[model samples]
Target: MGKEKTKIRLRGHHLFCSNVMDVDGDPIYSARFCANFRKYQQMMADPSQAIEVVCTCGDTCRYCPSWNEQDGKCRLYDYPPNANRIDLEMLEALSLSVGDEITSGELKQRIKGRFGTTLPAMCSWACGFESVLHCSQGQRKL
Candidate 1:
């Protein structure tokens, strides 16, 4: 048998972003961010791989150009820290919380069940999130 994969650690809101958006070759995101996203996508290849929800900057943010190590949030909205606020909102929508462990398929199904026909309330507000598309049904901006 093949080696088992470890959990995919990501921020709370990134769970939704991963489900909705595809940023594969988008210039808006830095090359490092794009590369990390690809690896994240691959991590989901095993449906059983656990998705660990985090409050601080997770694997996805580690490679983001706008990542802020000092505050452990995105540089955009640094004053109000909307990134952290938005993450909490997303977690509420999904009935999840930081440190929670869930499978990718379960998270996807929850997303579909909760917001399949409507825009996520968290995404409805514009916080200037640099990488993930804030609107337009989660399609790639480029």
Candidate 2:
């Protein structure tokens, strides 16, 4: 009998941000968040590792400082509205839907082919979106 491996679930926007952002040396996040993210990064070091796309609060969110177990959502997002907004944009830009399975390498190629190294950052907040994404919508994120 063959055993099947469970796919790693990652938030949609994380597909991009994870490449540029590092939780190490950052004190803003909870230890659990850092640990989980680091583990994800380590796993991504493998080219064959598959990542499941998700736009909602996911595994990483479980360790996020803003995550409230009782509410089962990030406090920064109202039932996933604000957070979903960012993730939805990433999915729309990539022309992908939730549940799509992709390797980080393939996704990176797609991003390069589509945006040519940078995607427009539409984040309205000072969340450092500029570091990884450029703003196409100018000052606001829709």
TM-score of each: 0.78, 0.74
lDDT for 17 in candidate 2 is 59
Stretch of 10 with least lDDT, candidate 2: 133-142
lDDT of 2 by residue, 1-142 (tens): 8776556787767776565455665444667777787787777767667889875666666677777778555566535346577677778887788999988678766666666644447444416545333333221221
Which ten residues in a row are the worst by lDDT in model 1?
133-142
lDDT of 1 by residue, 68-118 (tens): 877776775334645478778788999999999999878877877877656
TM-score of 2: 0.74
Over all chains combined, what TM-score does candidate 1 have?
Answer: 0.78
**All candidates: CA RMSD in angstroms?**
3.9, 5.8
